[model samples]
Each structure stands twice: as structure tokens, then as C-alpha cells.
Target: MDEEVIARYLARRDAIDQSVDLVVLMGSAVLESVEVAAEAHRTYAAPILISGGIGHSTHYLEGAVRRRDCRSRWIGRSRTSFAIC
Candidate 1:
């Protein structure tokens, strides 16, 4: 990627929307998503809606939480509720 293109992408990506209503965390193998969701919630004071079910990334998600010592609650098998403080 060209430096100018990368800079433009970063500028757009880092732009914050002032009218955000919720922080959504889609279940994935990447633990960084969780961190981002939590941070968003903290910054926006928006409700978080965690979406996903048991899949290839289930174990990875669980492991990531453990590794981070993240406090979380499971709302059945598909949905999870995270309290961002």
C-alpha cells in the first residue's frame, strides 16, 4: 500500500462518530475486538450487544478472556454480556 493511501485510510478509520448508540462485539477469534468493544463502550457510554455462537472461534474467545482476565458474563450459548467499567 502506498503511504498516502495508508494515511488516508487511517484518517478515515480513526474518525469518531459523535452519535454512536451502541457498541457491538461480534464473536471472533481475534481478542482485540473485545478490547476495542470495551473501549468504545467506555468512551461512548453506549450499550454493548455481543453477537455470535459456538463456532471455530469459541475456544479462542474463551482463551482470550482468560488471558486478559476479562470479567464477562454469558447470556446463553449465543450472546454474551460485557460490563464495561
Candidate 2:
């Protein structure tokens, strides 16, 4: 990765608020992304709005739920809501 890109990414990441009213988890292929969002929700007691369709990350999402041993039950289609265990 370029130094400039890394710097910009770190800067934006460091600017995030410690707590928020909501956590919008756009779909990602990485389990760590989901874990982070889940942690945010737990820490903030905020509702997570799961945007984006499953797309190509179906297996990744399922694997994450299993690996984390979370009974993730999605409610609704298109934009959904779920809570991690």
C-alpha cells in the first residue's frame, strides 16, 4: 500500500467517534469487519442497520457467524437487521 493511502486511512479511522446512536454495517467480505461492527454495537448499544445485499459474501457472513458462535437471525429482506451473540 502507498504511504499516502495508509496515512489517509489511519487519519479517517482515528476520527471515528467513541460512541454513536447507530451502526450501519455495509456488506464486507472480511470477518474482521463484521466483528468490529458487532463490537461497536455492543459497546454503544446501538442498532445495526445492515445495508447491501449478500452479493458474493454469503459464505463469509455465514462463516463469521459460526466462528463467533453467534445466532445471527436476520430480519427482513434487502436492508436487514441482526444482533450478534
Candidate 3:
């Protein structure tokens, strides 16, 4: 993703300052996109809820492994909920 797009997302996230219980990041960019989202969630002091299912476009096991790795990395200090959907 471009830095400009990421900056925009971060700006939007900074505009809100409420407790968030869940965050669902979907689509092809799930691996990296959710990391950025998780950073934003930390800034808001919110737990994260990730939801996405491996589709024909990607290897199911690989996607699941990557998502799990992301969860493990970010699951510290904040509660995390995950569902493959």
C-alpha cells in the first residue's frame, strides 16, 4: 500500500478516541492491512477482532498461518478475537 493511503487511514483513526471492542479486516491484503489496523487499535486502546476466510485466490493454510502469526504478534497487551469467515 502507498504511504499516502496509510497516512489517510491513520488520520481517520486518530479522529476517533473511543473504546473499540472488535476490528475485522478482510480481503486479499489481510496479512499486512490488519497489522496497520491493529496499530490504530492500540492507539485507541481497543481490543481487536479479526475475521477472514481463505478463498480460492490464496492458499488456505498459508493465509491462516499468516493471520495467526499476525494475531500472535499483536495479541499482547490487548484482547484479541478471531474468526474465519
Which scores greater on TM-score, model 1 or model 2?
Answer: 1
Give one digit per residue, the lDDT tens place, for model 3 in 1-85. Answer: 6999986875464455566666655544335565676776777666665554445545553456465664455334222233322
- Looking at candidate 1, the ten consecutive residues that score lowest on lDDT are 76-85
Indicate whether candidate 1 or candidate 3 has the larger TM-score.
1
**Can you give the TM-score per candidate against the true fold?**
0.57, 0.51, 0.41
As for candidate 1, its clashing pairs are none
Q: Which stretches of candidate 1 lie over 4 Å from their true place?
A: 1-12, 65-85
Cα lDDT, model 2, residue 11: 37
lDDT, each prediction? 0.68, 0.65, 0.54
Regions more than 4 Å wrong, model 3: 1-14, 59-85
Q: Compared with the true structure, what per-residue lDDT tens digits does model 1 show for residues 1-85?
A: 6999985773354659686798887778676666788888888899989888778876776776666665444324343444322
The model with the greater lDDT, 1 or 3, is 1
Candidate 2 per-residue lDDT, tens place, 3-74, comes to 999857743544456668898877764556677878788878999887766567767776776677655454
Instruction: Candidate 3: give its CA RMSD in angstroms.
Output: 8.3
Winning model by TM-score: 1
| Least accurate 10 contiguous residues by lDDT in model 2 | 72-81
RMSD of each: 5.6, 5.4, 8.3
